[model samples]
Target chain A: MTITTGYIISALLLFGIGMNGLMTCSHQLRKILAVNLMASGVFLILIVTGFGTDGSAIDHVPHAMVLTGIVISVSTTALALTLACRIQQRLNRSADETAEGNDDD
Target chain B: MNGGLTGMKKRKQSMKGKFKRKDWQFATLTSLLIATLVTFLCWAILKEPPGEDLTAEALAPLFVQSGVTSPVTAILLNFRGYDTLLEVMVLFLAGLGIWSQATVDPTNPLVFSSPATHPTKPNFHGPGPELILATLVRILIPLMVLVAGYLTWAGGFQAGGAFQGGALLGGAGILLILAEPQRISTIPPALIRFGIVLGPAIFLLVGVSCFGYGGNFLQYPQPGAGSWLLLIEFGAAISIGITLTTLFVGGRPDPKRLKGTDQP
Candidate 1:
């Protein structure tokens, strides 16, 4: 019933929606979540593109790629979050120091 | 994330008379983790099995070599081998990147606090049941290790392969981190380094080995299913281990130090 274009559109929508949130969200963690959402959506589309019509599959290449992609995405996300945590720690430290300065003022 | 964060224990000891150490935690992580879980649930509800046929199609010669069935080993070692090779490199790069980013060394045990503040969580409710932590890892690590081994070997015939098997192994490491971080330190740096770099290095070596025979890169002449498959899977195990470990811990778990060890 569904077309490849439709699959693509769904994937794009997922990515776009998540991207909007990632770009706009002030919360650091929310940005990470949004990125994750976008990644999932993209993988979904990749999977859809690789599907066969009735019984035969169109392409196995994409599926294999997606399999690899999923683990890579997960790993990248973990690294990104680690960065977020580090940044958060730095920000918190400066904020505390600034608060002390303002108290003196 | 809700517990065990002490960045400043040493200096705080000097000023302990005035400042109280407190634990701080954001309640939001649990919510985010839950949300991620739900999203995965939805995906599972709608997921399709990735066909072996798909992989077969890819490995089947595109134009000239269209007559024969595409082999999994062929794809891994040939057709899209570039992908696998680069993927291995990515793992290596990630480790190097994280290593470069390390502010401290892994050899140091994470101390109760840093030199500044007392070891206290502002939001620490209580501790996890210590017995549960120890017992859970004791049972789970072995089972997980077994499953990881199975995934690596079973990958040749089943829906799972090197990546899934590798992921399972990586998951075991993460589980160990969660249940008993003390054990994580005992794993040597050399082993970790070797394991993380093994996949790409070995993959490259294999490619070169084939190249020496006057063939293009990764064109292993050994087409027999049993022997070739074993070689490729072994490579997968190494790459999976390296990639997943670095990714799971975001490069490495270089905790804060106890400080006095610098002398010894």
Candidate 2:
């Protein structure tokens, strides 16, 4: 009972915080962190929701499902971050070359 | 005394505020629609019953007899096997995306020799490698491996599971990548690909191991559940570790080379 309540409250909080971060933050890393926080919050609620009805062993179904959820989240986040970094690298390089050429000219 | 580019950003922001407010109606409508859809879906899922699920109850034959405490393990390794397969696919996609982007392409748009990020410094910091940091990393790597194994073993009975253990192991690999980003190697890639396949393979193998006993893919007996879970988790650890490491290294500059400064 307590666990579910805790998860529900925290999940909402995380959702709000993540939304705020996504809205206000511009850096890619910060955006990822916010998204991750939101994910973790939802996952916690799901696991809590799985708590057994007649003491049937805290619903393994949700646990199992969330297990996969975590993996997929991490994988997608990794790929997104890589994309961001690549873009940053390109931007930095372009900016540097322009600065160098202008200095010489 | 000290003037950097930070002040320019603030100035730009304040200057743009007066000229802002271009698409207020569109932004508001889109955000409201998204919020409504998200909220409605979540409420529906939560309101759904406790026993009306086929996927949840069908496991009676495949797993969870009458009075069991850790049916959770069985659910993870067995019943919901297809979901696990899809999860592996996610990791595979992440790894592949990173792989393609990180790979050296001659025609890709990037500056090779911009003496800006990496001026002609010998080691960029101090030297080839600091003895202390290297030694610390050496000590930590082996410990992380042991921890990963333990997390895998503990998942069946405790809160630790394959994904958690696998991701942690993968974290260690990412740390290693940070040190040697430029010096690309096939080992990480191979390991990730292996990790991608290894987890499902072990999971399916153990699940099928129960088929002869008149059970399905992940059905577990009394004592075999623990052992079988251990095996699957071990495979999970390896796969997750490699795939995640590959993803990070693929995006960053090679440990030995800068991203924009390295030439083909």
Candidate 3:
């Protein structure tokens, strides 16, 4: 197969793996990682779309779009992680309070 | 009583077995679905005919007018600047969301404030940073800053740009925070807030200023586009760096802790 097709196939595999992880994993951090993997697969597809089969010039627009995508993904990841940590903290606190009440009983 | 206890234990074992079986079935089904979807996508891509890229060709002739030699930079800062503008705002909003969700104690920036009697702490509790790591961080931080500056400047002509420089700066800031959390607290919170706002505010200002020159928003006049792009890049790099660092810190800095009123 051509190199472009190879890349496309791998990108699809990556997306599939990410999707599987997102569906199966119970951990919040793992879910975040899965989403990031999916984003990377999409980015690979975008970059490959701009790849020239012949001696044509590569598209700069896709590269710029990828850069923007990377930045957005980073920010979103940060926000998601912060939210996850907050949720975990709340859960831990409530668990501790419940345990304390049980001990008193 | 013994028979009842044994029956309860058997029931629990059966329940566990059922749950495990359900989990396996769910995983298999999901995997099958994902594999099918991916196969279809790949087939579609392989079958599609190659199309001509009109945008790249259109971008070629306008490179000089966009004021930067690097086509990517030109596209990012001049041609499709609105996307970058919104991107910066998105980053700003993310930082705002993080800050609103939790507060980090200034003295121990690693510890976030929660309503719980015992606040959740990260696993890496220690007396202080190790001597080797502290030294390494001290050595690397200055070099990182220098490289970040170079990247931002080089973006006008080559591959480097504000995002890369800002990410590097953010890495440096993370190292600094990790090595000396207390040192971060000593810096005024107001300054941090200013740094976070600097990039988007300047970007918006530059975009709005285009109207004064008798052009639409973000429409740079042909003559002075390079300097304007550079100005925006510098501001964006600083803001991105600070915002990223704050995000790593994981919450807003507590003003009370900064004032030394709260020792915890």
Candidate 4:
């Protein structure tokens, strides 16, 4: 197979692995990692696709898109992490109260 | 009847051993499905021909018209400026979301004030590491700011741009916080808030100002396009830096909390 084809396959494999992790992983942190992996896989595909095998000039539009995508991805990830933190804190507080109630009993 | 049924079930279970478990069957089925899907996808991707690069020729000449030497920056800030504008808004909205969540339950203490003020990861503890870290930060923060400034300026003709430079500034801000988390808390809240909004506000103002000048939104008049792009980039870099740093800090920083805290 060609080198470009190899890169595409690798990208697809990463995307598949990330999808599987997203579907099956129970932990929220693991899910976030999976999402990032999937995003990187897509980014790789976009950049490689722009570099066509015909030896033509590189397309700058896709590069620009990827740059924008990178920034937006970080922002979304930050928001997701914040939500996860809040949820974890709430869960721990509830668990603590339950333990205290049981102790009193 | 119940005794006979239990005996029959136990005999069947012994015969089957562990091979017929439901969870195992489900796992195997899902694995097979995923394998088949992946195989199909790989085959399809490999079969497709790599198309000709049509966009490069079409966009190359237009690049110079955008008043930037780098084609990527030209496309981002000139040809498709709307997307970047929306992107800045998205970053702003994410910060706003986190800020709103911060105020949801005021009964609970602010994020860093709880007795359990530890982060999820094992943070630096003890005076030795703290002193080393503080010293390193003092050395690196100014250097990072200088690099960030260079990167923003270099973006006009090179691979770097507002995003990369802003990220560097944001990283420096995070490092400062890690070295002394309470230092940021001591800052006036109004200044912090203004810093966070500065990028998007300037970007919007530039776009709207174009309308009054009889140009389309975000369109620069032919001779002065370069200057406008530079102006927008500078404002965006500053705002982006502050927004990213705030996002990393998490929660809307309350001004009242700064009272009685020792200054750095």
Candidate number with greatest DockQ: 3
lDDT of 2 at A67: 76
Better of 3 and 4 by lDDT: 3
Cα deviation of A7, candidate 3, in Å = 1.4
lDDT of each: 0.59, 0.62, 0.89, 0.76
Off by over 4 Å in 2: A1-3, A23-27, A52-57, A97-105, B1-15, B18-69, B104-126, B178-197, B200-230, B251-264
- The candidate that wins on lDDT is 3
> For candidate 3 chain A, which ten residues in a row score worst on lDDT?
A96-105
Native contacts, share recovered per candidate? 0.14, 0.54, 0.83, 0.63
Q: Rank the candidates by lDDT, best first.
A: 3, 4, 2, 1
TM-score of 3: 0.92
Q: After superposition, how far is residue B158 of candidate 2 from its true place, in Å?
A: 3.3
Clashing pairs in 4: none
Off by over 4 Å in 1: A1-10, A98-105, B1-77, B103-129, B251-264
Give the higher-TM-score candidate: 2 or 3.
3
Q: Flag clash pairs in model 3.
A: none
Model 3 Cα interface RMS deviation (Å): 1.1
Number of the candidate with higher lDDT, 1 or 3: 3
TM-score head-to-head 2 vs 4, winner: 4
Query: Of the candidates numbered 2 and 4, which has the greater DockQ value?
Result: 4
Q: Rank the candidates by TM-score, best first.
A: 3, 4, 1, 2
Q: In angstroms, how far off is B68's CA in candidate 1?
A: 13
Please give the distance, in angstroms, between residue B5's alpha carbon in candidate 2 and its true position after superposition: 24
Candidate whose TM-score is highest = 3
